[model samples]
Each structure stands twice: as C-alpha cells, then as structure tokens.
Target: SSPLPTTVFEDEATAAQKAIDALKAQGIQRIVLLSHIGYSNDKSIAAKLTDVDVIVGGDSHTLLGDFSAYGITSSGSYPTMAKNKDGDTVCIVQASEYSKAMGELTVNFNAKQSVDSCSGKEHLLLGETFTRKDAAGKTVTLAGADLDEVKAIIAKDAQLWSLKPDASAEAVLQGYAGKVDALKKEVIGTASDLLCLERIPGMGYSKTPGCAEATRAHGGDISNLVAFAFRDMSITSEIAIQNAGGVRIDVPAGDVTIGTAYTLLPFANSLFELDMTGTEIKAVLEEAVEYAVKSGGSTGAYPYAAGLRWTVDLSKPAGSRFSNLEFKGKKDSAWTPLDMGRTYKVVTNSFLAVTGGDGYVTFKKVNDAGRGLDTYLDYAQSFVDYTKKTKVLNRLPVSEYSTQAIYDKNGLLQQ
Candidate 1:
C-alpha cells in the first residue's frame, strides 16, 4: 500500500509525465523508468507515455524469456515492446520472482532520443552444485561424470548460469547462517494427514500424489487451514477468507516446522479485520469465483474460508454462480443461512484487505470506506502460532470446507 496520502500521491502515469516533462526541459529525452507496478500496469503506462523509452519492471514476477531447456515456463518474450503515445517503442523487461533470474537488457536510442531497438534475456542464476532424485526417491548431489554432464548442459543454455557464490557475500551470509538454519528447522507442530494444496477444485494442479483427488471434493486443505488460523487468532473476526495461492505448499503428514509454515505461507502479509455485510461476503466470493473460473483469470483468486460455506456452479453465469451461502459464527452451535442484511466481521490477509489483490474488489471498497482494521499479525506467523497451539494439524472436515460443492461448466459435479 502507498504510504503517501491520496491527496499527495499521483498516479503512475501522471508522475511519469511530470518526471518526463522535467527531464525534457533539461534537454534529456532518453528516459527510462524503473517500475515495480507490474507487467500489465507497465504496458499501460508505456502506452500512455511518449518520452519514456524503457521500463524495467517487477512485482508481477513475470518470466519474460525462453527457459524451455531448463523445463521452466516463460510468460512472454524478453524486452516486450509496447508502442508509446507517439508510436515510438518502449521496452519492458522483468526477470522471474524471488531472485531466481536477472534480466539483462540493451536499449538503443535513435538520433531523436527515441527508443530504436531493445533486446535481452533472463539469465537464470544457479550454483555449481546440482542435485537430482534417484530411483529410490532420495535426493543426491550430482558429482563426477554426472556433475560434469550437468554443467555441460547448463553451459549450453544461454539463460542458465552455473556460477559460484561470491566469497565476500558468502562470508557476510555466514554470520547469520546458523540462526537462519536453526529457525528453519525449529519444530512447530505435526500434521496427522497430508494437507493438500490446490488452487481450484478438480484442477489437478498439485504436484503431490493423490492431492488432486483429495482436494477435488473440497478445495485446498492448506488454504482452508490458513483461514482457520486467521479466524482463530483474531479476537473479533467471525469468519476468515484466504486466497488459494496465498498458501503455497502441501504439508506432508509429519512434524511441522517453522520452515514448513513459512514455506506454506511465504508472503510478508498480515491479517486485517473487515466489517462486511453478508451481501458483501457473497459478492466477494462470487467475484473471486467468476474471476477464477468463468473469466479465465488467475485460479489463485479462488477463495477458501473458515466459518463460511457456499456451493458454486460454474455452469451458471456470473452473479448467479454461488448459492447456499451459510456462515457459522465463532460462538454459533450450528451453521445458519447467511443473512445478507447482517454485517459480520471478516478476517483476511493484508493482500486482500488492503490492496484488494487477486480481484477482490469488494474488499477494496470496504477498506476504502474505513470498515477495516489491520491486525498486523503476520500471516505466516499466525500459522506458526496456530500450529504451536494446536500441536496436531489435520485437514478440516468436508462440511467445514468453504466450497461445499462445485460443478463444472457442463453441470457435472466435480467431486
């Protein structure tokens, strides 16, 4: 979220224009904007600006180069060119997220100081060491001829880099290495059953075996668990909603650790409590479902919740896709029909509550209306705390799943 007041902050395009005007007044025409707005916004801004020649972007974690040899997917071509207002080229480039790769771009300016050409590749940085799972399903580091062959293959790929860590940087990291390692290994709880991670029911996106089957009837197990954690940790929230993508990984049945909790909920998100009417709750769920399924938007928009349940039918049109909405308050003994006129306190992550991230427009509206409060409870840490409190983590019962039933476009039950 922007720290600057709304009255003080200018939109990206407007700010860029002002900066460009100042630069042009100084006889500078070749302007490059370092942007973190995102790929879509970068393209939009590029189309609006006539003087900006290049946009190096992040925030969307878009992979913009071919990485097929390494079995990685590319979002689009590197240096994606967009036409400015004057029809001049604007080069946009971004490497993938989490420091996995770096974008190397070369931009050429014409005599008029306009963008003439741009080219680059996203270089995937890697250590010299390589490991692979053997036939016994054990991870083993590659060595000897195998290691040599792996290095040879990496050397052949332009995007793949087999570089050694800088000694100075390694030395700096070494000071905190033990602490980091210990924190990662710190035990938090135990999972009695594998908590499967799935974005949408029956999508079969999980890498875990039988995960698709496990989640086909219900939604993501871990996502629902995260929602439960939020609601449980909150003092005033009646229900908690979590995006499917917010919870990252499958939790295999075993000892759960701080590393597992962090890996599962990796983002630096906090909890927020929102006062929303039941009508608003249903509206947000419909919005998320419409975005996730019918609209062909990111499946990550799919929602899982605690203290709320609904049946979704993809065969139905938007605004009518969800039905049988129900809610169970923290003190309620049984599930009851959601009263659209009644307002309820809902707990959600900062991403949804603050920025309305993942197409949750209703949340943004509620927040804008000053009906939300930031709990400042770290989302990942909430899971760690809940795990520590509960000691035994298990998948929520089917009845407790936010998505009670889901039907595909053909009206066939997905479960």
Candidate 2:
C-alpha cells in the first residue's frame, strides 16, 4: 500500500501500521503478505500485526510457511507450513533460490466473512520438461520446450541466438562461464542407516533431523574440513568463500557415489582464499545476512567458518551483528579472539571472495587476500572416501529445530 516495505523490515512495525491503514481503506478484508522475511522473523511480525492474515516468505530459504505451535520445521529449504492456532492457514512457498523452480501458491479466500477451511499444495515449476534415468541410478528431469511457448516468450526469431540447425541438448543454457545441467540427478549415497532430516522416534528432530545435512553431507562441512585439513591453507591467506546459495543439490541418504558429488557442486566455483582482518571478516558476515533478502544478500556465502567458529546474532542489524569473533589456529588449539589488524587466510569459493556477493564489499577489496585453485572437487572425492572408511557418521549430527512431539530439550523422547 504505502511503498510495501520490502527487505528485512528495517522498520517493520512502523511499515506494517502504514500498510494496515491503507489496506483497510481499500476494504481488503483478508491481508495476505507475501514476503522474503525469514520464518522466525515472520512469526514475530505475525504476532505483532494482528490485522495481517498470512505471511508467505522466502529469505531463509525456508520451505514451511505455516509452522505448528511447537515451532519445529525440517530443513529451511522446501519446508511445508504446518498450522496455526486460529485455524487460518499461513502458506510459505518458494521455488528454490536459483530460479530453477517457480512457486505456485493457490489461496482460496471465502467470499463470506468468518474464517473457514483452506488447503493448498507446493510444487516445482517444470517448464515443458523431459526425464531420463542416468547410469548413476538417479532420475534426471530436464526442462523441455514446446515449439510454441518459446515463440510467445521471445521477442523475435532473430532473438533466438542460433539460426544453425544442429543441436543435441535442446534445453541447455549457460550463465557466466557455467553451463546448466538439463539433466537433474535423482539420488546419491545409499544409506542402510537413514541420514534422516525427519524427526526420529524417541528423538526430537533436533537430536537428529534427517536431510538438513543435505548440503553438509554432500559437501559443505566435508569440503571445508579437507581445505583446512591441507597443510597449505592458513589464516591471512587469500581464500575462496563460496556462496551457500550455490550448494543447492540434495544427496538422498544411501550408498556413497561419485555422480552424486558432481551434481551437488554443478559449478566451476573454485576454491580461493581471502586476506581479511578479523574486523573485516565480521563485516563480511554482516553483509551476507543483511543482503540475504536482496540480490546483494546470501546465506550460502555465510562463511561456514572452516577451522574457525564465531558467534553471529541473526536479530541484530546487518553490519554490526556478528560479535565475539574468533578463529581456530592452524595448529588446532584453543580458539583465538579476533584481531582486526591481523589478516587471516579464510577459504571460500570464487563467487563470494571476488564477486562481492551479499554486499560483501570487504571481500571484493583486493588489499590483501589471495586466490587459489578449487580443491572442492578433491574434497568432494575425499568425503566419499571418508564415508566409506567410517561407514557411519563420526561428527555429531545436530538438529537446530525444536518440537514438542519428538522430545524435550535433553533429547529424551516425550510421550
């Protein structure tokens, strides 16, 4: 209504009041606020703005818009809204961040006055598509083209980049130097044990939510571990910090496979390091979170803190949020407090380290950090090897979510 306050509120309460007044004047009975505000933030807003009907959001990449009273939803991506106290359904639908998917949310409002029954479904936008099973036992679905649709969407026949006749992969498209994989892989790493993102019996989802590790199990933690594991990577070194948005592939729980790794990191995102002051590093984090809702934002680039651990406050203003920063030494000793003057060799992908993703201007500053070869592939290989050796999870699989059905805080299942 009044400039639809976008991005993370910045002044949500004030903005909401303005919208409510304006909407009331329009005789808009039920208010549906479609936003990118994260789940936690959404809940806070819903509570404060009683007039607001339902908030459909994205930013956190959260899948579920409606969470049960217990406040537990599986992975942030592809979450299904649970339910609310008023019985009015709040829907959250997002076609995964990369535009690979389009979110379709159908809300049927009652022509009558009072609240009533409602239902909906979340689906991926498959643009005229085809499917095939790859040798890796994964089903690859590709976007197909109906000769008619393209003619309508594109301006002219000349707009079509090619007049040449011979072409095999019809749906293939390229962004930057990277080519899109028309074939989507179905599964990776078979597990006799469930690498469960779903909550288990006698265990809260937090105790072990299956599939939240979708990103980490396939790579994230594993790759960084390898990067830091190497003798060469160090603080004060120029390193590649990857945008987490790029790590979108999911590895279904099962047998460890090679093809799965390729699909997960379907990019030329090479490993590079940056020479950033401890203070500057904090600034980078702030940039990632603040800009997460905009083109300049990224949670994927949120620096997984390989070989280092630092505290980040999500609620704080973007830039000033992260505090008490520290990094574990190359020697693997106690964590050292951050020193702004001293530069550290932080490792990440080429995207964030150079491209200034998530408003990380500091990372773009070439004053110090250096670039390096992408060993992510090498690390990916090592993960499959490591899983084969361990034959099971070694690190503690943690579920950051909380729910009443599964168990209590201590991890003892609640009856």
Candidate 3:
C-alpha cells in the first residue's frame, strides 16, 4: 500500500478566499459566509475578504445587539459593519450563546455586487409562561394581572418572541421523548450546595445568592471542579487546565443527573494530555490572562486549573501579573513552588489543547513538538464518571482554589 498523504490545513482568510474565488467563478456575485470562527475572527476575515458581503458567526457566542430590556447585556450592535480590503461594505453578526437568542440580518446589495446596507436584530425566544421568586424564596408562576402585564411587555418588545410549540414538531419529539427523558433522569450524584458558574471572579454575575461573594476571591466553583475532574480522570496527569467558557451553567444543590452533566460541559470536546514544563504552563496562563483581561478579549478565555494556584494583580503588566505560583502533585501533598525546569503531564479539553484557540499559544507549541496525546475521553462523560465515583459534589476547600487572590487594575484588592 502507498503511504497516505497528510492533510494540510490553511488559515481562515486563505481558505475563505479560495472558496470565494470558486464561487465568483461559478457566477455567484454575492457571498455570505456562514462562519463558526467567532465574532472577533469573523471581523478580521470580513476585513480581509473582498467578495464576502456578510458573515453569520458562532463559537464566541457573542450577543451582537442591544437586549437590555430583557435584562441581558449585548457585546455589540447587530450587523456590525466593517470594510473589506477593497473598501466595500461587509456586515457581521452573531446570536448569543446557548440557544438563548437568534439573529436576523438583512443585506442590500447594489448592482455592482457590493453591499449597500445591512440591518437586523436578535429575537429572544420565550415561552408563554413566566415565573418569579416570591418573598418566601419559592418559585411561582405568574397569573391573572401579572400574566397580562408580562404578555404586554413581550408584545411591546420587537426583539422578544413568545411562540407556542408546533403541534407537528411536538408529535415528532414525542416518539423519542420517552428514552431521552429516561437518560436525562439518570442521577449521577448530588451537590451539597449550589455551585455557581461565573467566567471571571469579582464580576458579581453569579445568579446564586452568596455565590458572588464566595467566588469573588477564588473564581468560578464549577469551572474549578471541572478542571479537577479532568485531572482526576487522567490518572497519570499531575495538573489540569480548563478555559472558563468550556464549563457552562450552575449546578444547584440537589441531585446531579446525566442531563446536568451534559448541560454543564456541552461541547463535543475530548480530554488531551500534554507533557509540559512549569515554565510552559506559566506562559500559557499568562497568555490566557493577557488575552482575556489585559487585551480586552472574551472573559471566557480566563484559565482555571487543578494542582496549580497563583495570585494575580491586574494593576501590573501581563507578564508580571501572575505571582506566587504553587503546585501540588496530589490532594494530600504539600504545596510547593512550581519548578520551571520540571516537566509534568497536563490534562485539558481538546479545545485548549490545540493552538490558536483562546490565545493558548504555548499549548500549540507543545502539541506541534509531538508531546501531546489525545485520551479520546469525552470531557462531559469524565465529569459524569467522576460524579458517580465520588457520589457527592461539594465546593472545594478554599485552599484548593486555583486563584488565591486578585487585585484590581487600581491596585486595590478585590473583596
């Protein structure tokens, strides 16, 4: 048998240009790129391409419109306009993350095959019923005048859509609903307390009461736990790293089910192990913090880890921000200063294991050097397995948290 040829991947702009050229050759004058490279990359691609007129993007999960009336903050305006290399108009848009909203954009092209204008808004899909917590802290569904007032508010907001489920779709779903419901109901374990989900510490964005106060100094509880699970499942790995964005949703105090695990780590990512020196690990953390906090990138790029801890001062420059790095091989081991020359096995999701995602350039270098190995373990399943083995989920001891302390940009300590 002949040796198989290796596949060579091209950069986004190059690949997009090649496809656009083919389309133009086929008499397609207007090009709309259905992109998953994320909002930031989409804007860069739009600026580089001459033929692409519009970009519908994903991956970053950016909300590209004003949705404040619904108590949601948006990243930018809908149909963010840019200019191509030829100085022609290019429009880019993205809906929010987690299927919470849908973007609708309209582009008008002139006879010369250039974009003349673009406009649109995101519609937040909602059900007919609404609920609120009463003075007694019990959830209750609205009714009577309250229901009417809620309906009126929805009617007034053009971006809010309250739609009933389609009868035919409901019938189709019913066929498989029984098995799906059974799978979703399979309880793996229980949480002793609400594990709050927050991308960045001190943001006060956690929905659970007291979560913000608890996590303001330590960072996200769920993200740290997910990183610990990855390290635990890897068996031989000494450390684990996870991007905050990878773990989604809070785990309320109660039974943790298969559905909960899936919802938490929803992406189709697998576990990967990389042999890295402490110096490399430090560089990776700096890169993540630089991109997310210092460079005004997505807060989701913030790094979380098991077996590692550091204090970050936002007032300092990127390279100098992280300090007092420590490492422990096992839960029972004493924490010691990280040795820059020592090599250790690090486990992380496939997303951060590769280069160019979330500014983890050091991971790319180690992977390219042939020191990386894929465990082929589904990340979400790893958490499920961990839950079953432990039988209980509780907030990790304060000492085990990855972030020991953080200082704000003004050099004041964050509470």
lDDT of 2 by residue, 88-172 (tens): 5444445445643344555555655323434443333334434557789898864445445543443342212222322444433
Position 204, candidate 3: lDDT:
66
Give residue 83's lDDT in candidate 3 (0 to 100).
92
Q: Write the per-residue lDDT of candidate 1 for residues 38-119, one digit (tens) a residue.
A: 9999999998887888898989989988777667888889989899888999999988889888888998888988888999
What ranking emerges by lDDT with the best candidate at the front? 1, 3, 2
In order of appearance, the predictions have TM-scores of 0.71, 0.41, 0.64
**Local distance difference test, candidate 1:** 0.88
Q: Name the lDDT value of residue 113 in candidate 3.
A: 84
Query: What are the clash counts of all predictions, listed in order?
Result: 0, 43, 0
Worst 10 residues of 2 by lDDT: 399-408
lDDT of 2 at 71: 46
Model 3, stretches more than 4 Å misplaced?
1-6, 10-172
Off by over 4 Å in 2: 1-241, 293-301, 367-393, 396-415
Indicate the residue-level lDDT of 186 in model 1: 95
